[model samples]
Target: MLIILLLVVFMIGTFFGFMFIKNTIAHWLVGGISFLLLAGSVTMLTMHIRDNWGMKEVTTSTTHQIYTAGDKSAPYGMMIKAEIGKNTDNYVFVYRNNEKSEKADTNFKPDEKHISEAVKKSATYKLVDDTKATVTTKTTRCVWSSDFYKLLFSVGGEQNELVKQNSVVSVPKDTWLVLTQDQVKKLSQEAPAMQKQMEAQLKADPQKAAQLAALQKSNPTEYAKMQVKQIKQLLGITE
Candidate 1:
């Protein structure tokens, strides 16, 4: 829509060129501004489609899958398949932006130690003993200034909240983190102390084992969801 309007404006400006040949300055000014508008409109539209991320329905029962990028140039893909009460990443988030992130150029890669410390100092994630972090939304946005694109991904929801249940990997920036279901399995491995207890509980309860088998047969992703609820119940983690 906007592009069409810009094209129309460009045409009107071209018509101005013929009308104002006598006033060369007027023609030059209108023509230059129109060209910029056309270019800007094209750039914005391209970025919008490139940066779009939205929820998609799950269609598989597989426990995990890895999605590779179409190519390195368009590097990005991972979507966590989690149930809000089920699967989650036992993790803390440390964030960093580009050189212009701060008023002064820090030109430094974010250190995990510093990011972890910041998470600990925060009132929200401070006391979260459980490993899994609930992440809500994920968006990959490319910030274009003069020429280079500064791309970044944002993970939302409180630190303790289950990481986003859907796959919304940050594009090109940190695409590797959210690419596959392996992340959830990795997170489950983090709190082995708690998992050991859950494992023993499941072992003793043959009925649960049978049920889990049946559930897994039907849908592995859904099975993970059920297991997550079971573990939280055992650990007494609140919503």
Candidate 2:
């Protein structure tokens, strides 16, 4: 409606300005209208670009099931989970907190120059236009970040990471997994990535899989207890 009003105003200004070139009052009125229309259009276009193309901190969370391949020992693989729209009983949203620390003895530079690399190493994700996806959060970041970690961003600013003395490796909490709505949809569709990662791990460490299988087969009663405990933990049922 606002856009339509602007269009009408522009047409009226164009028509009147051309219709009365001899009248000083009418000329000033049309000039003022033209200036306002130009300013409003530029402002609106800037906002539109920022809203659709800019990066947003998606902190709203929803529950979804994870594929652990019956591994009762692994805790929740992700710190938070989300679903597509209103359907909560679906595949878990995948995210990993990757941290790499450098040894104190090693020649390292903890400067702003390396923040871009650090941010890249922190997560694996892609960005997309917000209009391509429909996920939204009613609450702002201040309300949505409760009990959740703040994902840092240094698009053009230098960010400092936490460091500990004498610790050989210092993996600071320098980054978080934040994605736009369309990017999240792109990621959610790649559910097979997690499966492949697990398969690769099993292939690399066959002994671990064999040990789990043997444990499950050798003691069915104990295995049942472990399974029960895992289910309770995943379900957030204390009793």
Candidate 3:
């Protein structure tokens, strides 16, 4: 819509410039400038629309902590801002670790209930201490954020234990941490090879894959269903 408007405006500008400018060189220059602007406007508008519609927003929170080597010293921690409303029913958590980054498999229908269950059952504290954290209910969603260091202090001596048990500790940045239903559908269509690649990688590196495998083993019923769904999608067996 904006592109069409810009094109129309450019055409009018070009027509006026050609009619008013007696100099051939000035007229041609003005016309060329208007055309270039029109092309640029169209390109920008197309990209804006594609980004807004093609990609779903996945809410991500990053918690950073600077831990001392051995001492339970006070570590500085901060939660990255959460994106308010990007996904229909899912959010992703992303963070950095060991100079390398990793992303978890996408989650679906991650509402307040799901998140509460995940926090209680999943050892996210092993990654970051969130005991003092509380969820606040928004008009359509729940939100929570905490200082990483404060969480650690709340954990006391059990911080290392939590770290050893959590996969959230090493999640990657800028990777799709979670996928909404629409985003998942699009990903399934466009990146069928992704699942196969992940499977092959897991097979080749059992130790490194243990983290995610542990998650699946601990929740076999849920994880199994997820795997089957992904496999069906990857094999073009959409139902």
Candidate 4:
């Protein structure tokens, strides 16, 4: 868009320059070509942005799900599962904690892996947009042991693998998967059931539940409060 706008501005300046010099023939030819080029460029840019970014609004009900694993004391802690859709193409999940905000794009393969890791870390996930592919890729760095992990994941058409201290992974178009609104609705509806199942599993294993409860109790109140704030934002309940 910026490029097209610049081109249009340049063409207009050239047209006026020729007109000021009283070059009628030059003005007519250059002006005509400029006009045509401007029109074509604007159309192409508009179409490209629209095709990649335009997404339909969803009007489906949503339900939240919380899960508690049976082996809470295990290295892998309790898992919170929320079903947004079974057949949706793209899904955006955002996480916020302590004035820090993190967004995850599930529209592509890298986003899937990214969100999966976030959820495992007990970060709050919010569905921002549930529509078609908009951006080419999403990138983010991971924080590990209080030090920022120097790796970036780029999700788009071609999937890339990073192995450097600071690496980048690009996902290919064929690997991009977008979910539909109906699928999201279905997942929302089933969330409560999944939660119930997890709760039952916890009940069957009191020791595990106790361990998880202890962990939660030990978590810093500040961090928990931050997560709550993020959750509210994801639900569109907070500004």
Candidate 5:
């Protein structure tokens, strides 16, 4: 609306100042003002086209089933590979929306920097977008705030800008784990010993081992959760 109004005023000023007015100074003054208005209109139009005006930040939330990064067919329990930094709190989460999927989906690539968090919640995974701004936030762009703003610009095809995408993944806290890089290294080095120890514990209790074997065949998901619980106990990892 402002752009159109400026254009209309420019047209009127041009017509009266050049075609109707008789005075020289008045004619040049009006023409100059009109040209300034026209320039302002064109500059504003360009900015709107470039999506650098009239935008707002919006947040949305979603949920998906999460899995650990490992074998796709039988992934470990939900875990976050934390990237330790002086001030950054970043997490890498692997997930799969489909229960039968053979591959896991990740929120960010392994090399990319992002911030994330894990919260204690239900068995189902919940992904909530946070509004906090961090150093890793993406570049800002603008979109039409509403239909009214689009009408004012006369260009309604604009998409919202992404500032940051911080995911807060909620998982069953009791079954999930967050391990740092050093801790992960230690776990990898001691994996053989831990596995043998776990096997020993199961063998010591024949009924428990049989029940786990049955559970694995009947309900693989529950079986995975049970395995994670046992590993946490062996490592003395608490919720």
Candidate 6:
């Protein structure tokens, strides 16, 4: 409709030009209507572009499972690692989406060529101890709300935009380890001391040692995970 209106105005303006050249009254009337249409079109276009006239921001959420990124054992159990950037405040988390998944997923898109700045501005990560089965991500962004207004300002308008996105991951309490790269490296360097401390702690408590022995015999994988979680807590490295 808006496009047709603009086209109609163009035809009227052309007719007005010829009439004006002939010095007639019809040209003045046509010229007035043409001026109004042109002014209105410009104003609507400007408003739609500058103020998002026909759109509203909406937040949508989705949830999915995630698993440990790397080996859980160099220090103790099951682990999820978030690698911290050397020069930036951002952290890169790697995780498998499900038990059957062959590859891990990162926070950014695999096809994205560059995402350092975009992640800093639009993404946030949180770790929670809720024992939930999945991680939830909420994305807030603008979308067209009025079909008529959208048609009116279809040209040169920003149809969609990302405002922000937040990901909240839930893990089992006391059984999951979330650590940074720096901490992982430091823990690796102090592994010998950590092992001695862990051995001493287990020997001094016969009940705890027996419980661990029973758990290891029943579930070796869970035992390794528990050991990792225990070491992480022992070193006070929770990020």
Predicted structure with the largest TM-score when compared to the true one: 6
Candidate 6: residue 198 lDDT (0-100): 73
Model 1 TM-score on a 0 to 1 scale: 0.24
lDDT of candidate 1 over 69-154, digit per residue (tens) = 12222122222332222233333232222222322111112346757532322111122222222223332222233121212212
The best candidate in terms of lDDT: 6
Query: Per-residue lDDT for 215 in model 1?
Result: 75
**Stretches > 4 Å off in candidate 6:** 1-27, 72-90, 101-103, 109-121, 155-161, 171-173, 196-207, 214-229
Candidate 2 stretches with Cα past 4 Å from truth are 18-21, 50-58, 64-239
Clash numbers, per candidate? 13, 0, 3, 20, 1, 5
Lowest-lDDT window of 10 residues in candidate 2? Answer: 166-175
Error of 6 at 61 (Å): 0.9
Kindly report which residue stretches of model 1 are placed more than 4 angstroms away from their true locations once superposed.
1-190, 228-239
* Model 2 lDDT tens row, 1-239: 24445656776776667576668877877866776785775565465345422233333332222121112233211122333236422222332212221211111222357664422221112223221111221221211122111221113221222121110111111111222345435545654575577579878999977876787779654554554444334344453
RMSD values for the candidates in order, in angstroms, are 17.9, 19.7, 22.7, 18.6, 8.5, 5.0
Clashing pairs in 3: 102-172, 126-162, 126-163
Worst 10 residues of 1 by lDDT: 121-130
Deviation of model 6 at 33, angstroms: 1.9
Q: Write the per-residue lDDT of candidate 6 for residues 1-239, one digit (tens) a residue.
A: 37557756766785666566555666666666676767777777677668877789998898887676555232222333453445443445656666555665675432245463266333334545444335677887778788887676566424557766666666555456566667667767887897788789999998998998898889765785677566767678565
lDDT of each: 0.40, 0.37, 0.41, 0.37, 0.57, 0.62
Tens-digit per-residue lDDT, 1-239, candidate 4: 24545576857866675576466787766776776777765665565345422222222222322222212222211112233345432233321111221323232123355664433221122232221112222323222221111111112321222211111112111212112345345545765776587699899999988876776678543334443343333334322
Query: Among all windows of ten consecutive residues in candidate 5, which has the lowest summed lDDT?
Result: 115-124
Instruction: Point out the higher-scoring one by TM-score: 1 or 6.
Output: 6
List pairs with backbone clashes in candidate 6: 76-227, 76-228, 77-225, 77-228, 78-225
State TM-scores per candidate. 0.24, 0.27, 0.24, 0.26, 0.53, 0.68
Please identify which of the two predictions, 2 or 5, would achieve the higher TM-score against the true structure.
Answer: 5
